[model samples]
Target: MQVFTQDDVLRFIYNEVDAKEKKSIEDALRLNPSLLTLYTELKEVVAKLGNAKMEPDNSTIDLIMAHSAASKMETSH
Candidate 1:
């Protein structure tokens, strides 16, 4: 039996694991309470990340652009 580590869990969550490894993890998830909990938590996090918008809103973008323009003006003078 291969020992699953954090990296393996992450890979499984991301669908980066090979078919055999994925099957192994899926099997473990059924029998191991702790692994199931970890998988559930990771799935939630991944779902949240999928819905997350990291880009700054228009107002913030405007503020940053204005600040950048101001800095350029100060440096050129």
Candidate 2:
């Protein structure tokens, strides 16, 4: 009857929990609808994040560089 938090679910998702906690979360996931729902949503988010591109695209980098160059010009004047 231990209540699990979102952090616990996240830890479970990332396999950061110990064996005992993992078992507890698995049991809770089966018996608790809300916890299961949270787990499912978090799992999807984790998957999406895992597949997400971590780097900014070329255009974005160019824009940032342009902005920085403009700032430097203004400061020099």
Candidate 3:
């Protein structure tokens, strides 16, 4: 079995990769216990972060929108 890459971890999280790849990641994790634990811990932290609510800054949002619009126009041209 080959060593797993960070991309595999991301794909495992998102379920975007094939079963063969998923199984490969699992097999790699079986050999590297630390990675397996890190994966589980980080996923739990991310889940909690997602569940936690935070207020968005209106000014920051407007600035981001303006910048995105400007970038889009530049790209389209």
Candidate 4:
């Protein structure tokens, strides 16, 4: 099995890579003890990023619409 780098783990989490590559990396993770430490760190980073909330789901669309409308109105005026 091949070893995974942090970039590989991140890409996997973000779905940047396809399922086939993901499975290969996962298999490597399961078989390699040394990969565990790097995997743990990557997992932490992924968790932190996941926890990030730049804006609430409901308000984001509303905010965008409001801003877009306002910009249009300003342009017309």
Among the numbered candidates, top lDDT falls to: 2
Worst 10 residues of 3 by lDDT: 1-10
- In TM-score terms, candidate 4 sits at 0.59
lDDT of 1 by residue, 1-77 (tens): 66788778889999999999999998988888888898899899889889767776899989999999999999999
Clashing residue pairs in candidate 2 (N, C-alpha, C atoms within 3 angstroms): none
Each prediction's whole-model lDDT (CA) = 0.89, 0.93, 0.82, 0.81
Q: Is candidate 1 or candidate 3 better by TM-score?
A: 1
Stretch of 10 with least lDDT, candidate 2: 48-57
TM-scores, each model vs. reference? 0.63, 0.64, 0.55, 0.59
Per residue, candidate 2 scores C-alpha lDDT tens digits across 1-77 of 99999999988999999999999999999999999999999899889888766787899999999999999999999
1-77, model 3: which lDDT tens digit per residue? Answer: 58776667767877887988888888878889877887787678778888879888999999999999999999999
Question: What TM-score does prediction 2 earn?
Answer: 0.64
Error of model 1, residue 72, in angstroms: 31
How high is the lDDT of residue 70 in model 4? Answer: 100
